[model samples]
Target: MLELASNLGQAPKAEDLSKSPLSIRGLTVSYGQKPAVFSVDMTVEAGKMTAIIGPNGAGKSTMLKAALGIVPPVSGQVQVFGRSLDEQRARIAYVPQRASVDWDFPTRVIDVVLMGLYRELGLMGRVRAKHRATAMDCLARVGMGDFADRQIGQLSGGQQQRVFLARSLAQGADLYLLDEPFAGVDAATEKAIISVLKSLREAGKTVVVVHHDLATVNDYFDNVFLINTRKVAEGPVAEAFTAETLQNAYGGRLATAQVDQLAKALA
Candidate 1:
């Protein structure tokens, strides 16, 4: 469970700090001269579903990519389970944005999911029967069992998203970082994905999502980290998600009425 108290001004509780699943300090990233993320600091607790909320171009995805070593950071450090990323890569799973993938790669769904086991299977290894079963199980978890034989290009947008999620499930990592998993997905897929995330939390796994929907943040996440080029606010959802913080994060892009509606909902 996430600690409800704000950890903004003070150091994290000693006991909690030592065991945090992900810890980032003074993280800065830049594309040439322009900075995308600046001096961000955050600690994500294990077994909590956390949402990274921010406006467009706020570096929400960039921050996640940086943590995964996909995007090189200008400065700062990230620790996973008190170890470097390379040392703990096997324990982390990443699901990139759907648009980033080449869906027309002429690959079968099960083959794509099997790629998750690459860490276990060396570069020159073969897929055994047990690995196939594991991939199928992951597909079933994401409600994509039936489409396991279909070509990746034939699936609908929601279905493709589900397949990507299944691949992450196949990794069976202790920590998950998902970028825009709900974008352009159907209601049923959304529900199914949330169910999987909740299940991960219940099973003592930590999930961090780069989420866009303000209305569903509290509903889907136990913790929230608001960012806009830097850390704006972070803590338990009920306490960290506020009208003022949303304003700061979105730069007043959200209408006053919209903020009021969310504020009322939270209250």
Candidate 2:
């Protein structure tokens, strides 16, 4: 059996740092000369769900990528569960935007999910019956069990998302980072996905998502990290998801009515 946390060979932690699931300091990302996200510092709450919200091009996705070492940043340090991200790779799971995937690739749903267990399977590609059963169970958890043998390109957008979530589930990771999981899906799919995420939180896992819908922020998340090229305000929904902070991040783009609705959501 795999250990939940890999042996990083680091000395003991100083109490508070060990409790932080994800931490980024002085994170800076750039697209050519322009900075995408700059000087951002965020510490995610353990055993909770957090949303990274900002207006278009505010670096919500970029920040996440940088922290995960997916997209290289100008400068930064990211720690996962009180250790360097590289030192704790197996403890993390990531799901990129659905649009970023290449559905046309010739592969069945099960193969994609099997990628999650690469570390466990090792070089000889020995996938035992137990591995197949574990993959199916993960698919079942995300409502994709029956589609394991189906072609990847044949599934609808929502179904595609669920399969990917199943893939992430197979990782058995302690921290999950998602990039706009709800971007283009229908309502029912969104509901199903959030239920799975909420269950993870209840089971002592940490989740961070790049979220766009302001209306559902309060209903769906325990904490919010608002950014617009830099950190705006980050804390619980009641504290950070406010009219003033919304204005600061979105400028005049967010309507007065939406801002008022956000205020009422906290009431």
Candidate 3:
């Protein structure tokens, strides 16, 4: 969430939206001399799911990475809950793309989910029975309880995603960020993930996703952050996910048939 604030902690004007879980201002990132994201700004609507949508290589993933400091930006500032991100790390949970993971790491599903509890477990604490119970509950919520004892590398892509989602749930963070979670999953996995995310929003937790599926934007997200190496549009889905804003981000890259589908999807 990148609003041009004259003062960081000053009282916001009445016109400003409610609390922002994530905000960024003039965020610019470069890989070598090539720019990835350029002067982007955003303010995530609290308690809602915001989707970062754009064409391929449009800096969608890079923007999230920069916000979380996974990749340093060329120049920018990121804040979470009106505070520095470093000050609010425990309040946020992130799920990266499955392709970026090492599937052969030989970790068990339950162990992976338990990693979310490291903060609660502290530096030298051992996992107690209560911790295992919490981890199992999280896996059950994602429909993977039966596989808790299974090896992570043996699971299918969709199953692995569900396990990771379970891990995120076990974190019990107030804000969640996911990068292309539905990219390679089956329809069932997509449905399961969206269902859980919507539940999180209903519980008043803020969620942001680097989403690639344009067809589901209107149905799944409350807000949209459209970008293409720059801020194309940002606001509620009804306002920012419009045909005009989408066309502005995608330009002539979308086929006519695809445009028709987007029309029906947003209608």
Candidate 4:
């Protein structure tokens, strides 16, 4: 179900594999004097689902924002499909954490999903009937077609997450950058999102997620990027998602049982 690449090891220094779906080199981010991410480097291969896994405050979400050019990096470069993110904006879709969004915003579920097409619609272009149909189709893909006209605030946490996924799906992008899409969602929603991610890989699209659940990393993604302010390790899940690697990334903060379970899985 997952394709494992042989090159599973620590990220190289300043090497630019721009030809890859996503390439980050020497990326650094700081909040005033506090460094959030320190000279991180990573490469996301095309046609795979890559999980950025680390403990809290490991700069996982910050890295995703930098890749999308949403958060300005103090230094370093981000390349999407061998070009600057701005130049390849149309080829990318981003799903931010649901907590970051204001569910109380006066908007319909369909309207929110249609926002994905705004890039194609432009300021002057009308949405038209086809666009609405497309939006509804995206909702249906996520099992929310029946709630298209409902207010976004009316949906449960899982449904809201699903709606956001539908928006990204409507974008028709080559690469998707999701920031904690699994946070606070129900089990059913988690299952649905995983299915969607697998479908994207089958269609030859790349998906990178800022994920926190180390337990599910292997089950959901083929590739794993472990970071903690600085990159700790990155490669295939089988190779990089090891107890030693997790300890290095989490600073021995993981529970003993977790470490034991990870070791058993590797064995």
Error of 4 at 155 (Å): 0.4
Expressed as tens digits, the lDDT of each residue in 1-267 for candidate 3 is 333332463556664422678878899999978899999989998999999999999999999999998998888877788777777789999999899989899889999999999888989999999999999999998899999989899999999999989999999999999999998999999999999999999999999999998988878998999999999999999988878888889999988778777777777
Tens digits of per-residue lDDT, candidate 1, 1-267, equal: 112122321355445554778888788889878899999988998899999999999999998888778988888777777667777789999999999988999899999999999999989899999999999999999899999899999999999988999989989899999999999999999999999999999999999999999999978999999999989999999889999999899877889999999999989
Query: Which residue segments of model 4 deviate by more than 4 Å?
Result: 1-16
lDDT of 4 by residue, 206-247 (tens): 999999887788789999999999999999998898989988
For each candidate in the order shown, give its overall lDDT on alpha carbons.
0.89, 0.88, 0.89, 0.87
Candidate number with the higher lDDT (3 or 4): 3
Shift of residue 17 alpha carbon in model 1, Å: 3.6
In candidate 1, the residue pairs with backbone N, CA or C atoms under 3 Å apart (3 or more residues apart, or in different chains) clash, namely: none
lDDT of residue 59 for candidate 3: 98
Give per-residue lDDT, candidate 2, residue 98. Answer: 92
What shift in Å separates residue 134 of candidate 1 from its native position after superposition? Answer: 0.4
> What lDDT tens digits, residue by residue, belong to model 2 across residues 124-201?
878889999999999988888899999999999998888888888999999999999998888988998999999999
Question: How much is 162 displaced in model 2, in angstroms?
Answer: 0.7
Residue runs of model 1 more than 4 Å from their true location after superposition: 1-16
Clashes of each: 0, 0, 7, 0
lDDT at residue 71 of model 4 (Cα atoms): 82
